[model samples]
Target: MKSNNTAKSFDYTGLKRVISLGLSQSKGLFIGVIFIAVFSACFSVYRPYLTGDVIDNYILNKDLVGLKLEIFKLIILLIFEGILAFFTVYLANVVAQRVIKELRVRLYNHLIKFKLGYFDRTPNGVLVTRSVSDVETIAEVFNDGILVLLGDALKIIFIVAMMYYMNWVLATIVIVILPLMMIITRYFQKALKDVYQEERTLVSKLNTFIQERLTGMNIIQVFNRQQAEYSKFSSINNDLKKNYLKTVLYFSLLFPVVDIVSALATGSLIWFGGLRTAAAGDVTVGNLIAFTQFITMLTAPMRAIAERFNSIQRGLVGADRVFDILDANETLPNNGKKKLEKVKGKIDFENVEFSYVPNNKVLKGISFSSQPGETIAIVGATGAGKSTIINLLSRFYDIDSGSIKIDGIDIYDMDLVNLRHHVAVVLQDVFLFNTTIFDNIILGDKSITLEQVQEAAKVIGIHDFISSLPNGYYSEVSERGSTLSVGQRQLISFLRAYIYNPEILVLDEATSSIDSNSEELIQLATTKLTEGRTSIVIAHRLATIQNADQIIVMDNGMIVEKGTHESLLAKNGYYANLYEVQFSKMNS
Candidate 1:
């Protein structure tokens, strides 16, 4: 996503930053590429002059021996030019690959440290495009942008100088066409710059749309929205097509105009040089031929300059996008110096208030406490701020006001990593990676061994069920554990949380989606998982938390009642009514 301050024209700052980073990677390679490009440009300009000398000074004088020697020298220059050209392209790409690799890695590392709100607000596809596609575009700055432009610029300079030295009148004729060609190029360059910006924007939209549609294909199919979704995709795709056509239209207009001017210049050179080539005239057969070659060489780079300018513009546009991510201040502030080596599990929320959006508070002046070894269950209807409490506890979002303390220190004052390390949350929607069951449980933590994982699963009473699978703990799971039943995935999540051995455990409606048989196993697992840990449980099913040391009933972001199950039942208040509603359903 582009910010309001995004540059609409050529971004010089971004270009400079990209160049600085590239040089930092390998200054030797960059400097070597430039040196080779200069030499290559000089060779191209001199080759035509050598060809003219062979015609006038050697071949025309009937000196076959001198002609062969000049021809041999020409061949050597061509061989060296070919060798330099190969190295120039090869080294430029090597530099590009290395630079983008560093940029991509840095961007990814920055993304991982960003607060959850950043991902919540920005689409995953946009970030993916920035990290992968946009970074690739920056490579054009090296392969075809900067160094190529330098070589072309140098070719123009050398060609013009040589033309004037040979014949000032002919050089002036070619120079007259140049300003007009440049004016035309400038017009197309501006038009194409705007089009390229639009093109990248449309591509991001296309990528974001496809990513979301594929992820939600099930919902689209279930609701019979295939035709409607297709229509939406077509609209986005059509916009991209139109954007590409605009780019084509500009180039289509640009080239013909440039060719016309180049042909006129070529025609003028021959007309003047032919008249001058008469018997007492100063221009010889060789000078006329060399001047003709000069016209061709001069216009070639001019034409290429127009194209390369756009390529450079496109890369600059991409660099702006990539740098946007790098410059963003979206990462969590980890300024606390206190390390949490251990915690007593005592939790407190002192008049805490928070909102995902300003003036739309989700948790309002809420306060609560749990002892070192106790279970605190919270029950509420949807949107009653049940899960918001858990999010605040984990410091996923900073509080609007007031404070939350763990053991006696304010959570804000604790090291962010250490604070999160001691808290384990098993969400209702369990997300598992596409790996073996053992890997998912350990989550790449080598400190937790397979034997330790097996032992933890046994304690949670899911060991036998896992052992029944063909690969046992080594069984492969599909993305998000889609191959497993909801109950099975949830069971694994509990085992994952348990293995971490957190000081505070949270199960946010963990058992709501389980079947009747799996519910018993989950209930038993919950007991074992929360045995000595200070636990917070959020449940829609009132019966699940009957044994909680304290049950807090909430409404509209505020707690309405708090007490033990038996005590709340005696009050016949919010908790009693909630319990009664579910109790009646169980009987019916």
Candidate 2:
């Protein structure tokens, strides 16, 4: 079932916490960034002051020497301001990259620790988006967005202070337009945020569609569904395009509107400052020129603030998605009570009941026990809860009620890792990485020698087949072992389990996919693999398990009959009927 809380908005509290965490890691660079921003703002104020000084002290008095000195001072201040700006950008970029790297690591580690159920429910594309695109967005916010906000805020404060000191009446005229600009910007920011968020969601969906299609391309071709797939992809692509256009349109309108407002503010300053100078003679020509420049400067910071706010909104959206994954509950605790230095391989299941969902039980009050080194065979129709029993015994999922003990201790009380270490399963569907055959076989114990790998393969009757290949045991398998046949993959899986030397061995229809010749070899290998271990074989072929010490017949999540094959045949019950059906099919 899907989570109920999926539709919630981005967590603002979590976002603030993440920002705080990032700042704490690179506090020094953060402090330096602020210092440089303030330094640049102060330097910006000096230019207008120097220009006013040039007009009052030199131009008005016809002092050429003083004009030359003021110009030189302006040049020096510009150079210093340039240096400060460069360092501020450089330091912020450096810190942003470092913090992003650490954040990525932390996110990846958290994902790895999450329970298998999380991966089962989450789409791979969605997780990939959080790790890649989301991190990139946050990095941009740190590097460019934060710096813009800091620099512009300081610049705006300094400019307003200077404007008021020079002439309150002219400053008031310019400031009057600001409140309207702010109101308009507030509306624009809200509308833009929604548009951008929609765009981001569409992008994520498109990514997921592409990833799923590419991974299953073979199935599409086999089913002649290429046209259908193309149509689906095109539909999503068009939606993405629409979202992108909407986002761009909103931004386009916002930028031009802000620019027009700033222009109007500038015209107001020029007109009002001219009238004041005409009346009082207190404002010189150079001071009026400086006031115009200050009004122009106001535009830069306003635009910067608008852009920064836009970035922050998008960043919050991305952060919300990332944190959603990080906050998922982990797997149930494996707090098995018994700790065994060595397992004797006896396993018992008593009155075990389990259900992935309530009122839909898959395994019902099952009861059974196997002696150490005994081979127990389970036979049943499809959906008979055969696999569910193995899953429960392996502790993949806890039982709803009842007890399962391995070597006489409750499975839940044993250390999870240690318990899993001693149990091995060879399943019908095998998964192999893109690595050498030897490496695949030795996956359970990488420290084992190559000779040990060969020995295990030989026991599983796959050594000759592996050696016949061009690279022999060193031959590299393709991803998912696509280059190998199903039978060959199963052989490799058996070898892997054999190499682990597990105390308990499980074969869940392991030989069902192999040909008769390979099945014979696998049966022989299975005998060797389970020679000294407790073995549970879930199979459809009755002949294969005829020699088992115990045979269980399960139907609809219950063990209907249990006994030796000979005894069950004598009883003429569920096992006898199942055996006859299979035997008649084989004879025919």
Candidate 3:
């Protein structure tokens, strides 16, 4: 998760690669569009020709029969043109929709597979903007810009050629202004593109600010910081407004300049053609009229080029943002060939060193081991690296140095999914999806039967609690489980971990949130659950781990004391001091 500035500067080659990938998925529709566009361009040539005929053989000569024939041909040509235009628009839209669908799915899938560290740094709103806004912009580019650009370029060429064939003098006068028009358009395009890029970037930032404040509105209100938040939002909003105004101003300046240039070109054609006609030249009144129409047609396509180029620049900027996510390195790679069929639950950490930041160690030279079916209690103050150990065991982040092994093979040598499959974690901060209670319980093992879910819930002493609900196991949990009490969420999370029945379990203050009554039941259930599994418990209450097979007391990322409860008590060291403080607090 780089800053927005860094993201903006991300290499566009990757974006082009992704665009190429998207187009490859719809080669058939693209080819069809190309074919229809050419056909449409061919039909466009007939308009100027018919107008010339009506002038030379009918208007000047007063041949009513010739006029009727020319008018009939014009009607037939219009009918064909209408059909080609409809299909070209239809096929282009179809292709655009398909490309957008595939691109969105690919981006979402890539996002889900990214490592935990990636999410830790990226804001939800930034990711959402890339997935939604960026994809939509690219789709618009495909539907309007690419399709029209192809057809219009062809149309311009054909129109110019027909005008020249009808009468080269009028054609030359009309075409001479094109070079000047092009130069002005190019300048406008570059300026507009720069402004549009700024506009899009500011929009993403505004979205991020709004999303963050809205999601944390509760915190803002509780802290009585509404005015502060409003001020912050206003700052970002003002930035967005400035960029938007600049973009609009550039577009405003562009259209008028183009219109004036086009009007001049048309007036020049009419004036010069009239002179040639009066000189007894081949030009007729109908030819001059058709020439004006052809020049008008040129205005649309030329202006279209300007509009299309602007849209393309905006889309490219968005694509760059999207490709940044797609190209992110997965810090945790799944390169392991071996799968643990049945782990012995034996774990070892030998001379392990780790740090999220370089050269600043969080855990240093740590060595420890747990036997099969053994309970290891880790007790430490806050920021003592208790969570870091669990993170390493789960391989959420790789170690900077040394090794962590399960059984005999290094954990890194085991398939990441399989390694995690053998381990289950119940954390203090539980997360439940907006789904039924039964579904949440079975989330750890989707294949578990209803009976299995019930059995695990009963063992964890939450079956009756869930049964008491209005919908029982079918009850829907609101977002973040706002409908349930904190203790209830904890109970449900414990049941989820028990249903998995992994060989290794880690509980990080899992019971700290529950009331005393619920804690007793959870303790009882945890005792039963760890009977034949390796368990690591991190708790603030020393009484909870009195029966643990062994206790390792940590301080500053190092094990200061290790022994059974009775042995550590007799040693009168860090463990004795910790137990005495807790026991004194309870008695008071």
Query: Which regions of candidate 1 deviate over 4 angstroms?
Result: 3-8
286-399 per-residue lDDT for model 2 (tens digits): 777787788778777887777777776677666666666666666558656566778998889999999876799998899999999999999999999998888888787779
Against the true structure, candidate 3 reaches a TM-score of 0.94
TM-scores of all models?
Answer: 0.97, 0.90, 0.94
Q: How do the candidates rank by lDDT, highest first? A: 1, 3, 2
Candidate 2 residue pairs in backbone clash: 335-412, 336-412, 336-413, 336-414, 337-413, 337-414
Rank by TM-score (best first): 1, 3, 2
After superposing candidate 2 on the true structure, give the runs of residues whose Cα lies further than 4 Å from its correct spot.
1-11, 55-68, 336-339, 438-446, 449-451, 467-474, 515-521
Cα lDDT, model 3, residue 259: 90
lDDT of 1 by residue, 1-588 (tens): 574324445667777888898899979999998899899988988988888888889988989998889989999999998998898888988888889999999999999998899999899888888888888999888888777778888899999898888779878987898899888888887777788788888888888999998889899999999999999999999999999998888888888888888889889978887887874587778887887888788888888888888887788788888888898999889887788888989999899888999999988889989899899999988999999999989988889999999998998899999999999999999999999999999999999999999999999999988998889999999988889989999999999999999999999999899977688788889999999989999999888899999999999999999999999999988888888888899999
Error at 389, model 2, angstroms: 1.6
lDDT of each: 0.88, 0.82, 0.82
Candidate 2, poorest ten consecutive residues by summed lDDT: 1-10
Selected candidate, larger TM-score, 1 vs 2: 1
Worst 10 residues of 3 by lDDT: 2-11
